[model samples]
Target chain A: MTKKVLVLPGDGIGPEIVGQATRVLDALIENHGLDVTYESALVGGSSYDAHETPLTDEVLAQAKDADAILLGAVGGPKWEQYDISVRPEKALLKLRSELELFGNLRPAILYKQLADASSLKPELVSDLDVLIVRELTGGIYFGQPRGIRTLENGERQGYNTYVYSESEVERIAHVAFKAAMLRDKRVCSVDKANVLEATELWREVMDRVSKEYPEVELTHMYVDNAAMQLVRAPKQFDVMVTGNMFGDILSDCAAMLTGSIGMLPSASLDANGKGMYEPIHGSAPDIAGQNKANPLATILSVSMLLRHSFGEAELADKIDQAVSTVLDQGLRTADIHTDGDKLVSTTEMGDAVLAALA
Target chain B: MTKKVLVLPGDGIGPEIVGQATRVLDALIENHGLDVTYESALVGGSSYDAHETPLTDEVLAQAKDADAILLGAVGGPKWEQYDISVRPEKALLKLRSELELFGNLRPAILYKQLADASSLKPELVSDLDVLIVRELTGGIYFGQPRGIRTLENGERQGYNTYVYSESEVERIAHVAFKAAMLRDKRVCSVDKANVLEATELWREVMDRVSKEYPEVELTHMYVDNAAMQLVRAPKQFDVMVTGNMFGDILSDCAAMLTGSIGMLPSASLDANGKGMYEPIHGSAPDIAGQNKANPLATILSVSMLLRHSFGEAELADKIDQAVSTVLDQGLRTADIHTDGDKLVSTTEMGDAVLAALA
Candidate 1:
């Protein structure tokens, strides 16, 4: 019996890049003898177009039963006119919350081949690889008692609560330490412990949780200093764990350091390791159907889907190596292209990566 | 009547840098015929060492009485062992809260001469000069009911309040718009309105306040996106305004864009225009008496002190021009030095700027 993988080629450049990714998935199943079966489904704007909802119950059911999900980018200017409640982006939020995908893993890895593309000096980012494990289900984003109201003095006041429970922090800490165990064996938990008492609880929980993973070293940093250090020396970080809001800022900051924003893949996982993989870059509507979209990120998402959901780390390593080998051979997509690199169409680049995989 | 300017040389490199700044201050009083009177005081570690309190009543009284205050860098590793309440950093928070210094202005300026020093390409930051107006006295940092507590289930929880009143937002908005009027006439107000309802009120207040200064264009950005934009294209901004926590992060991110962290100055202002101007950088305990610490930031603080507090815009322009002239002449402080640039001692750098002023 084969495991089921639900493929959601979402919107704009979604179909183009994800189509290329599926080709690689097929090759793995046929040639590498991977025991996986895939199912394609409508999601995001397409699902909205067909069913008047961004995520239909039928699609949601299929997704719930699948072993893993591989989503391409979603949303574009075309859907900007829709109500926020029914917008295409609501699908992603819905998927995460419904699936209980609490840990969002964003890896900022600077391939040596794309070193010159970074904003920092090549020496600072050439070997950069940092994983940011963001607790997505809780924190200020979902904290209650948040709204604008009239005060006793007749002055209007805007207020929100930043709260974190011990269990919430502990679970995310376990995810981070588990990730670090596979890489550098170091996890730095970032929070505003000195200021935000919510994060003070987060820090305490992180320390308590680390006791369970003695192999992984844990360090702490204030959120503000963490932002500075990302700009100053991003490579110094191995794995950084933080709450939703801080992680959103720091992870994006870390992603830009790689200069391959279009090539980075991310994973959102549940406690049991059931996950959703996707490229960090958005659906580039302008370049849709042009065969100019970079497909490696989507292809890498397939690799992450394999390793994280199916526990096939060796298969994922092969895909990563194949992408690197193609880059080393000087094949370039328009986005990551520099002078003297061979410019290739999306299909051509995808083919080269597949050939290298073989 | 002379405007009383209080000079507080705080700790570590404070005295060395402040001494050079006073040379420029003396030149303005004598050569430029500026009607200014000066007084000296101790603060931070020096005050803690002398009075056992980081800020004394006598010094606070002098600060309140002075028309303007110019401060050098404060705090050092030597005072790291002090109790949290008496720590040197406590002096800053006390001063801001006591004086009701609600507005903090941090200017991130990238000189044409040192453009290569930036992590970004020279084209991105070459002409960058953004003033970040931070609301210092309000928001999460000072909000009430922030601490760890036990839940009904005996699990620990931590929490903080992020609250802002209309008046707090209005005053900072005015400071930003007014500052923009003096620059490129554009203000981008950053908030986390979409998720954090507190910022929804902030957005409302910013828009309401913008009506008062229609000449200064106002735009809005979510805090997370603003962080990305600061790195992506910092030059696109003229002035930015935000609350205490967001400002603390964005302002520091903007400062690093210039790669001149040692050469930036900041001013914290009260409602009446009485202000505390200081370098954005901290004291380097390692080079306290060696005269190796950069004094340009301190000198620049003198300029801000003149303009913001004394309304001596012409004298302030002169100081800015003098500093730029020295940089163009290839005179370098130890921190901002590159190959072929003349590495001048702190005093030499100050003297050259004064010579340029003449």
Candidate 2:
């Protein structure tokens, strides 16, 4: 069975990075005999420019029909002036809700070679690997009864509901426990149960779901303590699962902790193992086409896409190993480069990864 | 005129640390001509044991009548088995609501002498001072229509409302801007306005509030970016203002950035400048009565009480300078102690500060 991949080179440096990533994918298909076929499509600012909308119905139909999607990045100053409905970021929200991509997996892995890049002491973040599983589609972001309203006293008030059902918690909890089983077998569920009733139920559902995964240990922490612990001692965690908003905040915080945001990849998954993969870094509009952007994160997104969506673990391992080997060879992009390391251009770095793969 | 100060020495190591803080207060009264009178009351586990309630009506009335309150931590494992209503923490929540303490000022300051204690590189957190003004009384934590209900499909749904009125935002924004006026005059209002409507109104009210404080510079950041920036470059901020939940998380994150939680103090202020001061650290039941706990944070809380509530700037500065002088003398408690520093007992640290004051 051939897995169909949709490559969305969104805006700014998207095309350059995704171009490098597809080169590696081409190698995997040609040399490694990986059974996957991919096609390119426009979305975000590019789509808005070409089709008058951030995401056209045709591109969305293509996305829904694909087995996995590889995204470069979206939104830039070019799209900032547009109304919120037609903005480049709308494409992402549309795809997420339309495809029901609820589970977001953000991995923060700090390679030992780039330990000095972190604001934290080397001991704190060196070789740090923490996977944050976030519920993406639901929670406060999409909850109803959300907007500004005028009160009887003529004062205006704003409100949003943070809501989650048992099934929602159960599904995300299973995703986290399954992920933990593959790694350290420990899941720290982050919530504010002591204060928020919504998270209190979230905690109960997590406890109920943990019975099915007896081999995996589960613990609960308040969000504030979790934030402090991330700074004080982040290594104490393996997999941290939380609601949509918490996941958004904690995942970013964890990514920054690695101090090499250019090397992180993320995945938004659906129930049936289909996912959209992308680098955690945003499109670098200022450095776009200058060959200064880092493509390693985008290349790694291909690895995640293969491992998660297609179950091609061996091919994914090869891609990950190629990345590690390139880093071991002291190949650095401008963002992660130091005086002693070789600063390679985006394409050259991608070539190095492809060469290592070969 | 004499000012009445209500002192509440709560559970675990609270009495020991508050005892030390009061010693400095006594010195200020007798030697420095500080016209203040003090009274003590039991709270938390002690109050629970004495009156079967964490906060008695008499004590609550005393707290209301006092010009300022100095507290030395709360909660311990002994009261964990009790129902949530009678729990020691309930007493603190009761005070915040009853006193209308809407503005929570949490300062994360890393003394240069103790910069080595931080997990971050010394250069990043040395002399770092960030005041987080959290709207204590409102937002998602206290929002209405929050509970878990069984749905039509027999699945339970948990929901909490995140809400803010214009006046609520105005008051907290004024708190941030006013505090900024006293400091570096920069306020960064953090919210999730792009997603949550409540925070959209929050941002709008903040912008409207900034007009009154012409000298202060106001900026906006998403809560997620604020969390990352706190870890990446914390010194770039002077004062940060947000709703209850964001403040609860970011303030703790900022506190941990200093890597010396034992030395951070916090103040909860009402609109009228009356406030309650306490250390950010909790009562360590394990280290209770061991003479090993650090009293610096509690002593610093006394300094905050004087400065915020009594307008005794000179006395507060004297206490602050004395604490600095004591730290300069190489005195250390067990928590912030490293290999080469002078390790002193709780009482000895207090005596040293008192001597420095003299």
Candidate 3:
């Protein structure tokens, strides 16, 4: 079966990085015989410039028809003057909600070659691999009845609701357990059950869901302790699943643990295993077209797209190996370049990965 | 005029550590001529054992009347079977609400002597000092309309309101700025204003309050970015203020960056500067009576009590200097004792600090 991929090269350094990622995909198609056909479309600031909306109805319909979507970052200072509803970032929220992409997979992998870049002792973070499964499109970020209101005493108060349904918890839990099965077969659910009743229910749902995955060893941790443990001994965790807000905080913390955010990729998946893959790094507007942006994260997003959306794990492993081989060759992009390493431009780095893959 | 101090040695290692702290206080009162009188009480499991309640009315009255309170620690497995309403930890919550102690001050300080203990590189955390001022009495943890309910569709939904009034944010903001005035005069307010309306009001209040403390430089950061910044370069921050939940997570993360949990102290203050001070580490039931637990955090709590509650900065500095001198002399407790350091028991560590003070 030929899987369809939608590539949305967004604003800032998006076009340059996505160009490299697509080049890698082209090689996989021509040389490796990967069965995939991809089409390009404009979204975010680029789309706004073309159609006056961050995401067009046509582009959205195309996204729905695709097996996987690859996004090359979005939003920039140039689009800041636009109204919030039509902003470049709005396209992302619209896609997430429209597609019901509730499962967000963020992997924080510290390659041994770049361990010295971390503020942590090299021994603590070298070769560290942890996947955080976050329940997106739900929780406090989108809960309703949220706004500022005036009280009877003439004081202003603001409030937002943090809510989760049984089905929501169930689906996200399945995503986490299935992800754990593919890796370490251990999933630690993070919540604040001790204080918040909402998370008390979250913990209960997690326990109920754990009974279904007998092989996966499940544990629970308070959010505060989880934060400390991430800093103290990140290696102890294999998979961590949590609500949207906690996931937002912990995943970012875990990414920083690697100290190479430029090399991190993420995927947002729906119930049907269809996903949107992208680099965790934002579009660097400062160095937009200078060919200096790191494209490894975006390229890895292609690996995620293949492995998760297209069910091509072998191809994904090959892409990962090529990345490791490039690093072993002492090739470095500007963001990750240290002393005595060969600093390569965006195109050169992408070329090295393709050559290694070949 | 003599100031009254109430000491609550709650449970587990609490008694042993508080005993050591009182010994230092005796030195301060007798040798240093500190004009403060102290009394003792029981709380937590010990209190439940004696009075069938975690907090007695008489003790609560004493706490209310006291100029300051120093709590050692609380809770152990011995009281785990008790009802949630009568749990040992409830005593602390009762005191916090009753005393209106809405300002929680948690300091993460990595002394140069203990730099090797941190997971971060020595330069990143050596001599690192950051104070986290948390809004204690309000936010999602204590919000209204929170519970699990059956939806019309027969699915169970759990919800919690994350809320903050203008006055709540204002008071906490003042606490942060005032504390900043005493330190580096830089206050970074952490919130998710871009998403959470509750924190949006929080940011607005913080901005409004910043005008009164013109000497204190105030900035805003999203909670996710704050977590990352704490891991990447913790020293860049001087004082961080946030609502209860973010503070709970970020403060613990910052404390772990020092890699010495047994050496951190905390304080909870009210609008009037009256406060309760304690060690951030919990009661270690396994080492409760072994004389192996560390007393430095509790002793440091007394130092915080003197500075924040008693306004005795000179006396607090003296106590801090003594603790530093003892560490310089190569004394260590079981929790923080590395190879080649002279291992000291609870009482021995106390004697060393006293000797350093003398």
Q: For each candidate, give its TM-score against the true structure.
A: 0.97, 0.98, 0.99
> Could you give candidate 3's per-residue lDDT for residues A1-358 as a string of tens digits?
8999999999999999999999999999999999889999999999999999999999999999999999999988999999999999999999999999999999999889999999999999999989999999899998988999999999999999999999999999999998898889999999999888889899999999999999999999999999999999999999999999999999999999999999999999999899999999998899999999999999999998998888888999999999999999999999999999999999999999999999
lDDT values, one for every candidate: 0.90, 0.94, 0.95
- Badly placed stretches (over 4 Å) of model 3 are none
Provide C-alpha RMSD values for all models, in order: 1.7, 1.5, 1.1
Candidate 2 lDDT by residue in tens digits, B1-358: 8999999999999999999999999999999999999999999889999999999999999999999999987898899999989999999999999999999999999989999988899999998989999999999999999999999999999999999999999999988998898789999999999889999999999999999999999999999999999999999999999999999999999999999999999999999889999999999999999999999999999998888788888998898899889999899999999888999999999999999999
DockQ of 1: 0.70
Ranking by DockQ: 2, 3, 1
| Clash totals, every prediction | 2, 0, 0
- Please write out the lDDT profile of model 1 over residues A1-358, one tens digit for every residue: 6999999999999998999899999889999989999989999888888888899999889989999999998898988899998889999999999999999999999888898888777887896889999999999889877888899999999889888989889888888988888788999999988888898889888898999999988999998888888877788899999999899888888888787799899999999889999999999999988999999999998888887778888889999999999999999989998899999989999899889989
Q: Judged by lDDT relative to the true structure, which candidate is superior, 2 or 3?
A: 3
Off by over 4 Å in 2: none
Q: Which residue segments of model 1 deviate by more than 4 Å?
A: none
Best by TM-score: 3
| lDDT of candidate 1 over B46-133, digit per residue (tens) | 9999999988999999988999888887798888898989988888888888899999999999888889888777887897899999
User: For model 3, how does the per-residue alpha-carbon lDDT over B1-358 read when each residue is reduced to its tens digit?
Assistant: 8999999999999999999999999999999989999999999999999999999999999999999999998899999999988889999999999999999999999879999999999999999999999999999999998999999999999999999999999999988998898889999999999999999999999999999999999999999999999999999999999999999999999999999999999999999889999999999999999999999999999999998888888999999999999999999998989999999999999999999999
lDDT of candidate 2 at residue A330, scale 0 to 100: 97
Interface RMSD of each: 1.3, 0.4, 0.5
Tell me the RMSD of model 3 versus the true structure. 1.1
